[model samples]
Target: MNTSLKALAVFIALAGSAWAEDLQDLPDDTLLGEVVTATENGEEERLLDLMREVQARGLLMFPKPQTCTFSYPDTEFFGNEIFRGAVRWGFGTDLRELAMSQGFCGCIYDLGSLDAFTQERIGKPAQDATTSDFSVFRKYRRSDWSDVNERYQNFQLERCGS
Candidate 1:
């Protein structure tokens, strides 16, 4: 099979597996709704919390005894780290919007045409340090700044300001 076909197969497998997990333990309906909305907007695919919640809800929605139990890590994602990284590189406005929407203070780093989710742990700097630099995971490295900008423009032209 070609690479695209292989990727499709993997996607199918993961989606199926994800659909089979349960999450009745989490009870915050508001958070659940936010997650669902963000996902629908194509933003939270790489968010660990959102993904975990989705898996849980999928399991509850499916309710199969033969399903597998999955686990997620304990970490803070998107917000702080994306800010620091983007600021370090002096990214663009759209990229900054992406980070701010995810929790960055501003968008200084222009990822060009790349879309990424910064999903890493937050770290604390020493008192002597001048900046609060953090690390993030490119969980969804397939997206870039240009992709985001184009999408935003299309959204505005097609949906918002029309």
Candidate 2:
């Protein structure tokens, strides 16, 4: 890794509880976190370990984690930024209340592993993405990924009752 990337990882790892609220739009299998960092974006097991380190420190989560991968060039609305990539992002709803009653309707965070095909799209999105563009998955939280996604799903289920 480059020095800048390494420094970024260190900075993220040592970040404060404020990270508990920082949000980013990542593709499926991307773990939901702020301070959590990984050396291998393509290694699922390694990514999970990184996420667990964050959870172990009580960072963030998405209970009942689900995922979707956009393999072709596609765009999705993630908060404000429009990301274009062969994306893999964690999926969930607003079940943060279950994790802790002390959160705001503030930030939605992202975390997880991804293959090299996924790239972060920059600039204005050509168009909004539809369901057809993504391959979705629903699974359990055995690791940081599973636990985070499970929380996300549970949050949505609990809040929306769907």
Candidate 3:
């Protein structure tokens, strides 16, 4: 091969290897944190890029197992619901469509219900809560996962059902 072709091939190979390495190094929490930060900053383009990267890498092949925690006090619990709603629904149609296509229906439904629940409880827009407020609420919540999926399912059925 000519010198130019040889250099181009080497560059492509290096870029491919670097991308594979980056995908291997990415963790679920890291990806989730980046998504949350993007939402907080209203970085729609960044969010779309991250979602595209996730799809291209096949990082989230299956919906992550849901973990329901019912130990949070009422305020913190409600705040978390609002935060999750904001984070999920905050994504633009393109991002939401990408995620749904990738099998994130359950997550979308659950967070949507959470957002609806907060609206009913507070009787106002829950999007007013800041990311900082969510961080503080998260700090106080129990890390232990509870088997409260049934309760949430019922709520979703009631609040998010067509």
Candidate 4:
């Protein structure tokens, strides 16, 4: 009986190690898929850990803004010129408000659409005073907006030399 129990413990330990090794061997896309699943399932802690791994691997991509007129409701938007100045000067809330009031564009680095999913789930930004408006804008899915933005950016680049 003691021998059987010892064998069972060894099996469990081996299985756990193997599982962890398999996870480490997974491709970036597979790991990212797990990140999305964790986010969708409201596993915030898991998502954070996975995001850290992704960042550590340098898998994150940040494309430059194709135009200075696009609006990013998910994040604070500032035009190219204003963004440069803000970087050189400061990134105060006052500058962001001024940029928004002037109808300038905002730049948010894409995280494989993870930010959109997070925005949809979180409902409101910390400083936003408005009530949830997602219900009113249910027709336009986040993925749809992403596709439209990608096409628009491509068109803009093709039409004008960027």
**Per-model TM against the reference:** 0.21, 0.20, 0.23, 0.26
Candidate 1 ranges beyond 4 A from true positions: 1-143
Two-way lDDT contest, 2 vs 3, winner: 3
Count backbone overlaps in model 1.
20
Taking the tens digit of each residue's C-alpha lDDT, what string does model 4 give over 75-137?
Answer: 332223443232212222223333333322232222123234334444543233123433223
Across residues 78-144, which tens digit of lDDT does each residue of candidate 3 receive?
A: 4566665433333222233433344332344433443443354444344544455454334322232
Better of 1 and 2 by lDDT: 1
Residue ranges of candidate 2 with Cα displaced over 4 Å: 1-71, 74-86, 90-143
lDDT of every predicted structure (CA atoms): 0.39, 0.36, 0.45, 0.43
Candidate that beats the other on TM-score, 1 or 3, i.e. the better one:
3
Q: Rank the candidates by lDDT, best first.
A: 3, 4, 1, 2
RMSD of each: 18.6, 18.2, 15.6, 17.6
Clashes of each: 20, 25, 0, 2
What is the full ranking by TM-score, best candidate first?
Answer: 4, 3, 1, 2
For candidate 1, write residues 4-114 as lDDT tens digits.
997986676456336633432334454355455445545555345655654533323333454322112223422345543442232343454554344322122432322
Pairs of colliding residues, candidate 3 = none
Highest TM-score among the candidates is held by which one? 4
Residue-level lDDT for 1 in candidate 2: 64
